[model samples]
Target: MTNNKKRQRVPHHPTSTLYSADTSRSESSLKLCRLTSNSSFNDNSTADVILRLYVDSSSPFVWDSTAEDEVQIYLHSDLLHRSKYFAALLSDRWQNPVSNINGINSDNDKKFIRLNFDVSSPTPSSISDHMTVLQLLYTDDFSSVINSVTVALDLLPVALKLLFEDCVKACVKFIEAVPWTEEEEKRVIEIIPLIREEQSRELLSRLYAPDDSCEEMLNGLIMSAIHNHPNTASVKAFVAKLLREFASRESARRVLERAFEESLKVVKESLEEYSSPDFRGDTCETEAIQRLNLHTAMTNGRHLVWLVERMIELRVADSAVKEWIEQAEFTVNLQRTFRDDAWRNIVPGLPSVVMRCTCKLANGVAGGTILATRQVRMKLVKDWLPVLIVCKDNVSPLVPSQKALYLDLEETFLRIISTLPMSDAQELLQQCLSFSTKNLEDCPHLIRAFNTWFRRATQPSLTGDHC
Candidate 1:
């Protein structure tokens, strides 16, 4: 779009009589006296119509929180045409305009129309100053509307309510420009329900969205949206897209790691109290569950699974896997208290499935007579073995209750070897054995399980070896 189009899109608010005054006069001279309980506008000689704005007197706009303290402004009735809201109020034939008129006071021969503005704000600071709202109402000065994020947010609904499209656009523009920190994102998400227009909602959603250049920013937006709207399927699907993008970008690997790190921190804090010196585990279960809010835990567990699966696929680094395993250890204790499907699937089922698939692939290569097949198998196993080993070593201690998890992984390992020709199976077993022996002495159960599978599988291979 050209500058003229941009200029046309954002309505300009020029100087007007209500706010702007002679440079020689001080600003205080232009300041309208804040109305008090007994104050009434004498519209007789000065203006054609006295438009009274009755906000929550408690709102700073009225100086005091009382019904009689309505802010009164004098303006020509034709000015209502500038605002669609006011125009409709006066022109709507079916609506009872007379009912809206509280009373008419004829002062100094001018007609005064009294109407309640009813601005909603529970506290004084919650809404914008009455004078600023009035200035925007009558004049075209919108520069102050976008001055601050808080002001912009507060003004948006008012702008929409008063049919101030220009101010609404300006607010949207301001929101787009400002950096939406996590807290601000949450605030924006919460207020989404209050915005009535589809255009405005889409604009706000776009503001929350990150551009393609920053994967982490997009990740953060998705996380925030998912956090706020956990049940929304669209938000969850967006998360999957973000994960795929994160996997492809080598630079985003650290960003992905950091996001998981922050999520794990929440998990850590929730479980930390249980490990405290003073607390006995018996009574702490209920308190712990409350602190580890079920919704958040489930979301994080799903996130954990998503991150781990991507990390494994991208082959970024084993450290992320290790960190996740460490976090999963705390979750093990929860199995005794809560047997959630998502938690179980992530904690053990997924990892077990991964190993099973890897084992099957290695087994296929072993039975292949072709040299290329065997070479491909060797490279695949060489790259995958350490990751499998780390998971096996770390998770075994973490989830001891799930004994079958280790058994399945061990059995899968043996199945791969058994399918291999005797020599190939033996060599693969030796590679695993060496790694386990060096790094995983403490995981005796896994070693023993591996040894048992190896022995059982190897015996048959040995007997048929030369046959």
Candidate 2:
């Protein structure tokens, strides 16, 4: 019973017998060993290294060129060191010798030996054939061989560099998949500066490429962001900028907010597009304002995340809606008060609104007319998005009628006299005009009211600064 317990609890470092490249024959399988000890290790007596060799069938090997396969080792680590069969190394691992072995194409200066043998065998003829391929590595009793990667990198300077992007990506994948410890975390912090900007750009540029493979590069970026120490700041900033510069405003905004809250400049800019609510043409409604309204209204009661997720879930089958979402910016702290009956008044008499522009020079993107056809669609639905936020500074309760809604709206107008955030306030006022423009016929009374007041207020004798 004690022996069984010991066996169960024993920590075993598998012994290995690595195969080496054949000097006489051209074909052979290479092997490696994770050496634990040297004194008693022998290839014939020990079976230590376990392996799951992954190989691509299509990679110049196997029957067809499309499949991949893996071989599992039901053994120990010690067996690795005794194997001597060698093949070309592709990625630190011997490329399946059965396939076209591709070790250092020219660096074969005995880092490996060459073997050119001709044999066509589809499968292992017997168990021994497979076992025979497990060659043992040659070293001066293990203790003499220096396998320290740091020492190797220093001795062979080429080993210290990271050139193949795929290498960085693979390492990053392994890093992200594993949990980081404080010590490991510190190691990453120290490593960031050693990398060059151009090299980083080469990796970052992949994010903008027009292909799905870009996702791999993006993963590398996100993983890098996990270490946000001062050195990582540059990489982090570059990544955020790449997201902003390449992806849609919506996608960029989401990534920005997710990466780091305090560093969401891209998101703020994107939201500005929606917040301005102005698109200069005479489409009757400002695309931005209507968009914010419909979206804000739809998710009015929910948190911002809920609203975003709901949009994703709804997958609203409308082109404009989709575009608005793709392009909408997320800067506002979207937590507005949407009482149950809030939509009842503003929406019933809703104007297909557009924001007017104050630009004297020709404003192209910022100019005249954006179509709010989507807002018109939203108006048909019961949901509402408020374009004008009335921080009703000590005002009477909003009455339930159009008169009350307008009276409160008039308060918004009066605030103009008080000088609000001029840019936003001006933008809001212009949007109100677009709303008025669309519903001109319905608000004739209100329009007429304004006209009458304008005529009286602007008369030559009337000189109050309020005008």
- Candidate number achieving the greatest lDDT relative to the actual structure: 1
The TM-score, computed over Cα atoms with residue i paired to residue i, of candidate 1 is 0.38
Clashing pairs for predicted structure model 1, backbone only = 13-140, 44-108
Q: Whole-model lDDT, candidate 2?
A: 0.32
What lDDT score goes with residue 40 in model 2?
23
lDDT of 2 by residue, 1-467 (tens): 13111111112233433221222111222223333454222222333223333333334434432222333332322233232222112223443222223333212121322222222124322111232232213222221221222211111111113132332333333433454456655544444345456434543342236654455555456546434335655765576556545544454334423432322223334334433435323354664454455444332212222222322332211222323233222302221222223333434222111100001000111111222243332231111123333222212353355334543444324333223333333334343442343556754444644454455555776456667
What's the TM-score of each model vs. the native?
0.38, 0.21
Candidate 1: tens digits of C-alpha lDDT, residues 327-415? 34454334322332323333344344344434433433343421233434444544555556555554544455334544444444554
Model 2 TM-score? 0.21
